[model samples]
Target: MPPLSTAATPPPALRQIGAWIAGLRRADIPEPVATVVSGCIADTLGVALAGARASAGRLVAADARDTYADGPATLLAGGRLCPEGAAFANVAAAHALDFDDNCYAGFVHGSAVVVPAALAAVEAAGGSGSDLLTAVTAGTEAQYVLADAVGNGVYHAGWWTTALFGAVGAAAAAAKAGGLTEAATADALAFALCGTGGLRACFGTDAKPLLAAQAAAGGVRATRLAARGLEVPHGVIEDPRGFARLMAAGAFDGQVPATLGRYWRLLDPGIDTKAYPVCLSAHAALDAVRDLMAEERLSEADIATVRCRVPPVVAANLTYDRPVTPAEARFSLPFAVACAMRYGTLGLEHLDEAVLADPSLGAAMGRVAMAADPGWNDDPERARRAPEGAEVTVVTLRGDSFTRFCAMPRGSAARPLAAAEHAAKFRACAVLAADRVPGPAEADRLYGRLRSLDRLPTLDGLLTP
Candidate 1:
């Protein structure tokens, strides 16, 4: 085979990104942006602690202990490993429950992947809270901006954006925290993009969070390698045989990258905190279902049938109608809707075997039917406005039907959760891993530390058992 051609100079977008990543500081981050990122960090760590109590989380943590040599980076579950290993284990745990935050830029689980990588890198480098905040900002913007540049076509094309673009984002975090230069940071991103990819087919399986963890770990590895003078093609994102062409199907927007620092995607199309542990696609419907149930005071026996009209993406992601496992239930609209109808709310506790085997829940799941909204694609503006929105209808046994539409769920950026609600979520998750922590008081202390991440001098003992 002939020698492969390489870009003689870095793309303008890549060069700009490198400069931004190299110069980003906590002081430069906007107050609002810092607050949003801090919330994501707090939420991610809280869920990661709970996730460690999960089977997948426990297995991954164990593997990290056995496979990676000990290092300074601390796992949220409890213990130390190399930065890459720690990032991998912690991220897996954070996402194992599908409760982490989401971003619409690429329809990716941004913080679940970015925050853990930033934490691991900062801890390994003995960096301060400010460093962690800056690293997270850098990583989040890098991934979201790149996703914006390519649009969501890649995601619609059956690619898992969290794993595809998350590696590059994670690398940006690691590089920023490690104090790598602009050029090296750019190279690290390129290496990460070149090395990472995942299929959407992994959505309902353990592979989903496992690939997320692997992407994060790969990113940390890429940054360390680049810091040690490793170099890769700089314009790989726009190269003919590179990311855009191979992954995005040649759907590249050249202008999106130029808006990197000026347009903070993290704030505008902001982070979405998930109130439910299930797929984000199901949140809107669940919100609507619960609302209708409360308004009508309809018990499970009062509902006769239910139908949900959702955007194509929602219908596509929530594929399991009669889920048998916890993983499947997280991706199943039927399970989420059924649980909501039966209990008025769905939480981590509802994933227990006893809950899953409930005859009423199974019957309720059977009653729930999800179909793609015919008009979803007809109106470009509506589709853009609510890509994952849902219209839910509940029919009572008395032959009366009520319909509710939810453009966005409660924890979404448009309708954010209150501080108290966020805290409640954190405490709930922390309690799940009570055996690892002292008690509710320690969990509360940790919550305070995580929320004030920007003020902490170091992450040395913040997540310690």
Candidate 2:
């Protein structure tokens, strides 16, 4: 890898992305984009703090602590590790509850991986808050641009695009945070893509979030190696036998990189901030059910049947009709709709074993059903427009009907959560880690710091009390 922008090796597409990353500055980002990036970083940190006590989070944090030497990067759970190790553990915690921000760009949980990686790399480099924001933008843009170029064919092909593309995004963010030049940044991208791939089978299990950990850590390692002048294979993404061809089934477009800085994908397709902890595939349906019940003033006892009309992709991903575990419940549309009918909301508390074993919840799940709209097959564009959207119909035991269609869930870009709502969520999630943060007051303090992350001179004491 070159120390400066020589661009002697990578193909045009990869080099174009590298040049964008190298040239990105704090001022180059539009205020709106930077605002969204800041919100996502704060949200990811909040969720990570909450998820630290989850089974997956606990296991990964322990593995990282035991395996890697201590260093400067702070884990959102607690303690410090080397940048790579910290990223590995923190990203897992961010994703363990499936509460992290999602993007249709690559159908990825973008911040769950990118934020932790950027946070670790920037802190390790002693970079400022502005540097962290700039690094996140660079990373998110590169990943989303590539996702646009490749389309969602790989996702439809059952590859976990979060892992496949997130690794590349993590590399971009880490490289930017570490101040790598264009050539070295391109090499980082290449090395990341060379080893990028994951299975969708990990869904509804601990493996899902752990794969996020692998991507985050792998990306940081790739950047560190590139910064050390490692000679990397160039054009790994566009190579005939490489990422695009193999992972995306030859679904590659050459024009997406040209519009990099000229257009920002983050503000357009935007991020989907989840309101519910369940799979995003189930959120639209959950929103619809919540609305129908509240509007009609119907209890779970009054509901005879609840039917969810969803896109084929949603139907495909949410296969757990009768979930017996919390992990499984996150992907279960029945569990999600039932929770909506019973409580009008889904929270981290609903994922507890006692809640999962509740017979009332089980009966409610039995009343809910989901099916794919065959019309989506005929009108592919409609499905593409609202891939995770749903139309729901609720029938009362008294023979009355109430129906609602939600094109997007509440926390989505079209209907963003209020700033106060973000703070409320942060407080709620933070209180879950009682062993790490002392009490509600401390969580509020941390929340304030995260929301004003751009003001911090360094991240050294940001997470500490």
Candidate 3:
């Protein structure tokens, strides 16, 4: 294999991936695939609907109105906007709570990146429900493949893989829904590469949601530009100074198919739904805290100190172990662990300003410490591999110590949530949006429609204002 920095000509495989995404739109997606896609769609909407009333979501909505476009697509908060604006706003809303599903391949939030683009594109084209589902599957698969190709090496080089490759996945999804030709899809992909960039330093800021929104908007723009016969470099992905070369330390060595219809990666690996609102990497620590709480019957008053050992990757991304704000706490391993240990559950309420202002939570957060354990680096095969989980050791004032190791979080693929659990989560998140829609009956009706999304003739039915 050539060095990643080599200015190699565009490889045929790169174009083939783009062609493959184009082909997925025309291919027959199985019922199982459709069901999963529907689930993801419903899950994303529930998150968005809840987030629409959040501070960030409100700001995005206000901005969308200012940058007005004459289009039929509905921004999550209220009025209609152009497809790109809608995609941007919806993506921001979906991720405002950080509750969307994740793809471990590159640690990208699958639904956050793909769903908004799909919804906006499909709505703009007046596409059928089936068309929207197919495009989502294709876009999600493309994201996984690309993230797998570049995520690990890029993260190792201090890049956020989701914001980087998410543009390509979002573009691919939009292209498929917009019915772009293979060449157009390829060009759209290249356009996506030109617009791709995001930093981990912006993790705690509004920039995190903006990163998702930009990818969503940019992807739609790229596809629309491609559909208009715009030209872009064919070898943009593999060329020197291209995405893989500039953003990642490693080259793309994986065997991506030469044609678009080889295998559906969505069915192979599937998506991982999140049970918590915080970063997925912090999930293990939360689990460990939960376990210690249950086994040792530990209480805040009895606990003197909490120590967590996690993989280096998790430690690297969770730079703020003791954060001052809710957003900062979301990315803080120690803060999440401390909250889990103190409150016995980490939820939206826990992330509230009032909860964050709790003197007890702050003191507990201060007592928590995290260490990187080499033994936890168990995901050697994953693109962005990390330690398997966290080991929490809580020492009590009475000199009693309790220890628990979490290998996987509850909602992870290894321990998938049951349908009832998913429904419960949906209801819980929906409650947060009670003021927006203002009735249990309305929420139930929307939830019922989403649960049966595939049967609907059009997705527009689900977006009732």
Candidate 4:
């Protein structure tokens, strides 16, 4: 169903999110909200360490180092930079592999924008871990409310939600951490929203994740400018040419009155952590096929064809039937599903350069077909509840067909990974991230630090050599 049109009734306070964040406090966040904040920070930092090795990560770090001198914020694998510059590099690393956590309702990568911007602000202001948590929670909630209010129309129309709407959340985080007044925080958000947007067409290139990096950096800068007396239009969100009107292509839902802080989007319509670094859209198909392969002992040789029935939203992204590059493969159902069928799993190794040239893998990719299932989304609310739904069927050379329906992806809130499993995943990524792998003792220590970040006096120790 289409979102409520702009003709719908809306109150004057439609874009009051900044004012809301300006009023939030550490004590205001629920314990569950704080827990999600900690989990997001821990997960983002882990992925960023691994992602910092990617080409885009290196480029952003190099640029920041060349452009800005040392400062309070840590730049992950690289040396220090000014807070804004550091935010740019760190955000790049966090999103480099598209491995960061994401919320389905918000339609944004929550931590990719919030953590980098809030962390920079926290370090610059000498805030406590609780301060950091409060800032992140506020900022993430800002984006969630705004995105939900913006409706799903913008996302379906190909606007990159994180890149476009992420700055508003970033501004909220920075303002909260830096002690901006509610009015000033509101001003910062105005400037931030004005800088919105990125296109989904950039998905198969280095530009895709870099958009996230830009949003984080831009948000920090906007907050700083606002602190320095930058005044922007207060009602920009609801103005005739304003955010919801123009950016959303006039398909605004204007549900802010009903949504803002009434219930936490973080707890209710929670985010999903990834088991595979590929697109979330492909996870259900991959999971279904991988399970069938494991249970039946099916190999690439025995498999003749694989069919995946997915909703139109997911079908839109599974375009590359036979991906020729790692970037493309990350969004390809054929690549993820076929490889999982052939190898019985898809892991970090699948992202290596060798997978791109493997003829056997290419042959398997040829056997996988993805089709849009209108019936899959017949009940839109039900589809939204289990967004990863997929009907997967695998045919063998012996004319046998095995089918399974997957409604949830692994690492989702409903089907969460074990705590030990989550830590093991961090280790796997970290081993490839740094020049010297942390010893088991060091790894354990770091994990403890992340878990207790709300009490840490300073974040300075996290990235020091």
Assess every candidate by TM-score. Answer: 0.96, 0.96, 0.92, 0.94
Q: Write the per-residue lDDT of candidate 3 for residues 108-209, one digit (tens) a residue.
A: 787888888888888888887777787888788777777766546676576776777778888988998888878889899889878888877887667788
TM-score of 1: 0.96
Q: Candidate 2's residue-wise lDDT over 142-191, tens digit each? A: 88888988988889889998998889899999999998999999889888
> What lDDT is reached at residue 87 by model 1?
94
Ranking 3 against 4 by TM-score, winner: 4
Ranking the candidates on TM-score from highest down gives 1, 2, 4, 3
Give candidate 4 misplaced runs (Cα > 4 Å).
1-15, 255-258
Clashes of 2: 0
Q: In model 3, what is the error at residue 36, expressed in angstroms?
A: 2.4
Error of 3 at 53 (Å): 1.7
- Model 4 Cα lDDT, one tens digit per residue, 308-375: 88888888766777778788888899989877866777887887678868988888888999999878
Position 444, candidate 3: lDDT = 67
Which 10 successive residues of model 3 have the least lDDT summed? 1-10
Give the range of the ten consecutive residues with the poorest summed lDDT in model 4.
1-10
From the highest lDDT down, the ranking of the candidates is 1, 2, 4, 3
**Residue 462: error of model 2 in Å?**
0.9
